[model samples]
Target: MAASMSVTFLDVGQGDATLVSADGHHVLIDGGQARDDAIVPLRRKGIQQLDLVVATHAHADHIGGLISVLEDKPVDTLWYNGDEHTTQTFEAFLDAALDSAARYVEPTRGRTKALGGLEVTALHPGGDTQGGHLHDRNIVVRVSQGACSAVITGDIETDGEHDILRSSIEVDADVLELGHHGSRTSTGQRWLEAVDPDYVVAQYSEGNHYGHPHGEVLERVERAGAEMLGTGAHGTIRMRCSGGEWQARTEAQGPVVAGDREAEAAPGAPAEEPPATEAEVGCIDLNEASPEALEQIVHIGSVRAEAIIDGRPWSSVSELDVIHGLGPARVGDIEEQGEACVR
Candidate 1:
């Protein structure tokens, strides 16, 4: 088989989990909040063993699901920033890491290694933690194969961005994983200018309480003339690169031309699945439905109903799978009942 590399920005609901594979060797960046959020996607890709695994930081949203991955899969090497954290999730991750078969390494800046056929360079956490904040202590890494490269920024804020810039690390890449879930605090003008990415992926949940990929950051990315894709609206974004060229595909939106700057589906592309009819509309349109209206569904309670309301503007009702604990059977039932509608 020709050497191929791909990255999957998993939609783990307000968390970050990316699977990077090059020529069949795999390295899991950050496992999201739930076990299936990480494992299901891995199993689907037919990845039973991980060559390397990285926990950028100790935050639950970043490393929570990694515990399950460590317990379930065979990982050869586990890399993490050596920042001390006391949260139960962090402690559990540590225990799992210690017990797993993987060799543990706390990588620092200026280190370079080969993962399968890809080259990886550590570009952040040059030294001790900054400002005593976990977000500031994030580990940044760049993965490259031939002319294609990607930078994975692990929830680092503006200060961390500056730190990377000051170190003169090569931040330029074809794909830039937006820092801090596209929070205004990251992806500053200078950083975007330096990267000049062809595409950017913001890993975040739709309708999350914390507004991510903030308006200002979006404007900055547009100004940089790079295509932006969010896990929130786009679902899982997959990029496959061979030679010097790459193409992106989404779970729902279909294939995305790598150089296309459009943030959403093409202008003439179908905007959404056909809307529920007036009779069906009597039940509820998920995008427009109120919490009270959603509660009328068979298994939907006040909490789930509110969650459904919060996760709005569904391009398809299938997005309900992003909601924790809502499986395909439940989603199918909801769709059949026609009680919870979608645009």
Candidate 2:
């Protein structure tokens, strides 16, 4: 088995940014809304150069941060879905890629590449994007190392999902980044069943006007018997694959065996001790603490931390309940240990 492959689903507030690293080679899937949204995490992870940078599609939320990355980091190659967009962000991204002097390749379906020990396969937009919805033309990529695999579905919708299913391609993966931020129009029952993922990560903003990761989509993910984690709730979900096994850990949730549908903690795993009370840790101003910092509060795991980050500038601790999974009990626990500092 290779040493380890790490996948980080960055919390980029209403957008998607994922980093995959194996054997010192790195690949960035998408960039969030702001430069720091992707840069800060990259710096924290000590990633100075990217083996490949993939702007799954030409959306601002997905390509905006890549402009900064291209300016700051030395990316060897760039990949896109071949969909054209007239937006300023997409244009700027293209200019940056050109300026960065990286090899630019618009991948097609069935194209595969080996990045160190990881195998990356392009699974979508097999052909032209002329007549289809933009979202349906997303560049879906499957990454695998040893026995663990993860599929990164950009903003693909139901039509794209069905197209992928009909193609002679494999959709099964241990971790599936839910399509279109878990919108009802995507992740259909048949699609989820076909993927049969063990874990699903949905990246969306809390209180998003769009109401992403809709209740219905959540229900479908549950019905698929897959453990779901939302970047809206969990700050950054990290999955590490090693020795033919994988484990997922969030800044708040510590570590859990990845792909375990039973949600069982690995043997000899530390007990699920409650976090430090707000009083002990001092009041965390919901608007000020970084997503990584918010994870320290009692009962505030990655998901809740992300929710708190999303619902920023809280007027009172009472407002915490608005975040999914925070509930009344969890809110009470947080209030006792910390104060919601709102200006």
Candidate 3:
């Protein structure tokens, strides 16, 4: 059987779309901004049904591909943070939600649902505050299966971050979908401290204007010791949850067996030693493995181990801070090292 539940993050240049399957259920977080382009990737990844469709906000990059996603697969439950602005893309999302006969869910601070055995909970969308407020309000969804969990934060910014921090919500997550494509204004240090995810995933188009994942944001993400995964680089990120051992699959990676990590240790095994499985390098599941399991990589040490265990499923590998020990290391070195073994 597959090792675990799966989260497939499509590389749709500058757009956001993640296909997730866990415990025999499928849930799509969002489609790329280009609905047509997004559907092709969905088909490529073998996505057929969308048990839940979440439009984090009314941004084009977040929901432009909704029509295409629904066209390919029926969306069972549609959720979006109600917007105060009336952008064309927002209207399109509402239309698709209505036409598809989906149950529109305005997620609150603590609503939960069961997708197979996986648990999905809402953590953001405290609603637009009274008086003047920055409009980055978003519907952040947290999906968990056993010990693994990932928090998907839609185009939220620092102001929105404040609201989420103030709420009586569980901000602690294994992985955090970096807000606003890793904008400097979104990942506040305090907020980062609260989540301290093992991975930080970013959704952005290649060569797009407004240079997403700004340098400062990138530095902050790295400083936090979380890893970064990108649609720009990782191709498509897919994960599987097998009880507590979350196995990940991606267009850029291969396969792995648990025992392969241990018993084969050559003590001083060269950091450049070959991987036991065809699994992608630098990528690890937070739900599985141990401190020693973490040290298998070249530069990884005790501190990095703490970060991995401290944070569960990471949004991406870039935020994992491998550079802390390895330094601008090549992808092959840490690519499949089990970023966060979250189940």
Where does model 3 exceed 4 Å of error? Answer: 1-3, 127-135, 243-343
The better candidate by lDDT, 1 or 3, is 1
* Candidate 2 lDDT by residue in tens digits, 1-343: 2456677898898898998877557899999978778987675444568988889888899999899999999998899867789998888988888899788898888888797668888988767544456787788999887777899998988888888888869889888998888888888888888888888888887668888888898888777877777776555677766665666765435455655544432212332554333232234467875543454455565678777877776787778788887789867766655434454
| Tens-digit lDDT track of model 3 for 1-343 | 2224566677777877876665446677778788775677545334456688887766778788887776567878888766654777767667767778678888777888897667788877665443343245577778887777787876778877788788857777666777887677688888888987766777776555777777788778778866566655445555544445544443443432333432122111222333333234324554455554454333455577666768666665555554345444533345443343333
Q: How many residue pairs clash in model 3?
A: 53
Ranking of models by TM-score: 1, 2, 3
State every prediction's TM-score relative to the real structure: 0.76, 0.75, 0.69
Quality of model 3 by C-alpha lDDT: 0.64
Clashes of each: 1, 6, 53
lDDT of 1: 0.78
TM-score of predicted structure 2 = 0.75
Q: Go through the candidates in order and give each one's C-alpha lDDT.
A: 0.78, 0.76, 0.64
Off by over 4 Å in 1: 261-343
